[model samples]
Each structure stands twice: as structure tokens, then as C-alpha cells.
Target: MKTKPNVLPAHNDCPQTTTTGNSRRRKAHRGIEMLSAMGWWSYAIIIVVCVLGMLFGLYIFGRSGSEASNLTQLATATQRAARTQAGFGTANLNTVLYNAGQIPNGWTYSSGTIYNQWNGTVTVTGKTSYFTITDTGIPSSECISIAQTLAAGGVANYLTVGGTKITPASDIATINTACGNANSSVNSTTKTIVMYVGALQ
Candidate 1:
């Protein structure tokens, strides 16, 4: 009698092995899909954050621009009022400027008091030779920006940022330091800009 020859069984004969292999492949596919979904979510989140940052930056820029324009208008109006009165002469010029239609439009004016873009008090006071425009509740960045602009334009004889006087020679670094100091002071959230313009030439 001849011995039977040894041979391997067909793959279909092992059901358990086939099932295990299929299960492993399925699991790996599912894992790849999950990872792809997470990557897309992360990308979307980054886009949203960037868009929000841009919007916030735009809001700040617009606010600062409006404040600077309003301040410049007020200063010009004050000069006009002073010339009409022949001199500033220690008088409060708010009412005079408002009555003359000199105050900028959209400014909140009540009881001879005008409010700035930030709803802070804006006062116009006069000395013998020059008038002062004092605006409170300005943010530190805007304070520096407006001060530097006016100083460059040669409009203001002198100005103060948070009570720190800024001269023509004051550089950006100096202004930044002054604003930083003011913002860290008692009025931590806001600062003040006081601009002095000459009266009658």
C-alpha cells in the first residue's frame, strides 16, 4: 500500500481565517476615514479663526479713523469760534461751537457737552491765546495714532497722551511708551488726548 501524499487545504476551506482578514481590512479603512474627517474639521476651524481676526482688525481701524476725523473737525471749529470772539479768553467754547453748527455731524451733543466716538466726554476750553480739545475714553492705540497724525500735520501746537505731553520731536517709540504707561494707569482701559490749537493769528 502507498502512503497518501501531504497537501495544503484550499483557502475557502478556512472560513475563520478569511473572516478575520476581511475584518482587519475593514477596520483599517474605517480608521483612515475618521482621520480624514478630523483633518477637514481642523482646516475649517483655522479658516474661521482667520476670518474673525480680520473682521476685528477692520473694526478697530474704522473706529480709530472716525475718532481722528472728529477730533480734527472739532479743532478747526474751535479755531473758527475763537476768531469770531476775537480771542479765546478763558471761556468754555462748547456752546459757541455747537450753536454755530461747527460740531461734526453724528457727534452726541447735549446740554453743551459733546461726546466722542467712544461716548467719552469731549470738552473745548479756551485760554487767552489758544483753545484746548480734550477727548477722553480713547483706546491706547488710537491715542497714539491720532496724536502722531496731528503732530505731523502741524495742526496742534502740542498734545498730551494720557497726561503725558507729546511734542513734535516725540518719536513713535516715545509715543508708544507714553500710551503704554497711560493704559496701565488707573484708567486702564482708556486714555485721553488733549490737543492745543492756537487762536486768532
Candidate 2:
């Protein structure tokens, strides 16, 4: 018998090992490109958002500060015009009335003598959006000047005096309507005269 043919490893019997190095490298490159593109877009978007937010904040802050400053100035002007330096007992009503001007609200002045009412006193009081000059026995004519001052100060509603409601009109007409033709007596009958003035809220 002839010698057995030389035994050689069969092609299908040996473990098959396939190399995927090229495919893996290609996939990795694609993934890296996608990640890089996403990172660049995200960074750009973040920067834009931050810049817009800062600009908006600055605008709001500036507007608020301006409004606050305007209010403060208004308040100061009102206080300066309304408050009197004269004390309660030593106040001169004529002088006070003469010096009165258009002023904001929240002012009061108490004086011992207001009209020729024999030691009668008066109180000029201001509410949140209105002002009142009150006296037990003062002539209604005294309110003319005061009303004019109030009007110049920005009062728009109807003014009242001596238990009468006076509708606003022209400067002269308003004064005439407010004071009227009737004259009140300075007697002990407690005839309170109140001059009401409307103010901005």
C-alpha cells in the first residue's frame, strides 16, 4: 500500500478570524464628526442666549431707575411747596396763602388764626389724592387764590367750598363758582368752610 497522503489542515476546519479594523475606523470618524458639529452649535447657541439676557436685564434696570428718580423729584417738589416753616401759633394766614403754589399731595398746615373769626383756627390737610383747607369761620373768597394754586398744581376734579360743590371751568370762572356771590358771617355758629382740591393719584 502507498503511504498515506500527508495530512494538511482543512480550510473550513481552522477557526475563521475576520478583521473589521477598516469598518471600525470609518465608523469612529463619522461619530467624531457628528459630536464636533453638535458641540460647535451648542456653544454658539449658549453664547447668543447669554448676550440677549444681559441686554434685556440692563434695559429693565435702566427704565426702573429712571421712573424711581422721576417719582422722587415729584415728591420733593410737592413737599417743598406745601409745607410751611411757620409754627402753629405764629403762622400768618395771609402770608401762607400768598406763598402757596401748585404742589403735590401729603401736606398739612395748622394755624391759630385763619379768618376774621375771632381766634378761630384752620387746618390745611392733604389726603392721598386730594387736599382740603378747613376753617370754622373763613370767608369763601379766600379759597379763590388757593384753588388757583391747586389748579396750577394739577387738580382736575371739581372743587368744593362752603358746603357748595363748584364745577371746574376757566380760571376766572372756577374761582367765581367756587367763591360764589354769597358772603358768610364770622360768627360762633361753627360754620365750617372747607375748600377741597383734587390731585393726581
Candidate 3:
């Protein structure tokens, strides 16, 4: 009896997928994570923009007319102040000027030998200064336009006919510009700016 030997099937060598496949898998995972991070960052940016917009809106609305009520009350008090006010006494605004800040450049309180007595309805310009002055000491701490022309950008206290130093209820002081343009006032003396002191309009 001849017995034939059985041949075994050949096993072909195949490429193994371990490190390369793992690295590819890792890269794909990292790409997905990065996209997620980017999306979150975009959302964060949108939120920040919205918050900023709301804050700005609040600021604008808050500034609208909160000061009006206060000014009205102040006006009532000052208008009567003029009635009780006595005649003007002597006080060189210059003496008080130094107590204030430096006198503006190109604008001097106008050096004078005699102190200009602010009597009756005195204007704060020309003989005294080209800059006109309307006294809050007069009525309602009211700003009567100097009618000359100017905007200095500082404050001026009114030494009333009586003796009161009337301050504006609120513009901070009188502005030398005109109230016609925005909310401001001016004097007859051009370039002379008075402080604005009144509640915001």
C-alpha cells in the first residue's frame, strides 16, 4: 500500500495594521476635537459681543433725562432769590479769580485800576472783559445769554446783587457756546466761555 503525503495550504504574509492604524485613528480624533473647540470659541465670541452691546445700550438710556426734575426745583428757588437780593456790594471778581484756576489764555479778566462794581444788571464783558457774563445770582440762577458771542469752557460764580454766590443747579456751569446748538449757552462777548451748571436737558 502506497500512502501519499498530504500537502498543507500555504499562508500568505499580509500587511499588519497596528501602529499606522492607531496613528490615523488618533489624528482623526484630534481633528474632531479641534473642530469642537473652534465651534465653542465662536459661540463665546458671540456672547461677548451681545453683552457689550447691552452694556452700551444701558449707558445711553441711563443718561437721557435724570437731571431734569432736579433743575426744575432749583429754578424755582433761585428766581425768588433775585427778588430778595439786595443791591450789589463791592467784590473784585479778580480777588476771587485766583481762588479759581488759572485765568484762560488769550482771555484776561482785564487788568483794571478800579474794581468794576457789578450793579443792577451788569454784563461781564467789554469794559471789564470782552467775555460777557450772565449772573445766576439774578434770577433762577438763570443764564441770561451775554448776547455778545463765545464759549470759554470753564465755570463762573455769580456774586449776586445781594451777596450770594449762585451756582448753577446742574450744565455744571454756563457754557460760552449757544444753547441753540446742542444744550449750551453763550455770551455777547465772543470767545468767552462761562461754565455750565444745570441739570442736563
For candidate 2, what is the lDDT?
Answer: 0.47
List, residue by residue over 53-159, the lDDT tens digit for candidate 3: 99986754432222122222222323222112331222333323323432322222443211111221212221222122333221221222321111121223321
The 0-to-1 C-alpha lDDT of every candidate, in the order given, reads 0.81, 0.47, 0.33
The stretch of ten residues in a row with the least summed lDDT in candidate 3 is 113-122
Kindly report the root-mean-square deviation of model 3 from the true structure over all alpha carbons.
13.8
The sequence of per-residue lDDT tens digits that candidate 1 reaches over residues 20-50 is 8889999999999999999999999999999
Better of 1 and 3 by TM-score: 1
Task: Evaluate residue 69 in candidate 1 and report its C-alpha lDDT on the 0 to 100 scale.
Answer: 82
Clashing pairs in model 2? none
> Which has the greatest TM-score?
1
lDDT winner between 1 and 3, please give it.
1
TM-score for all models, in order of appearance: 0.80, 0.29, 0.33
Ranking by TM-score: 1, 3, 2
lDDT of 3 at 44: 100
Report the number of the highest-lDDT candidate: 1
| lDDT ranking from best candidate downward | 1, 2, 3
Model 2, 42-127: lDDT tens per residue? 99999999999999978655543432232233333334555444312223233344355322222222343333222334444555
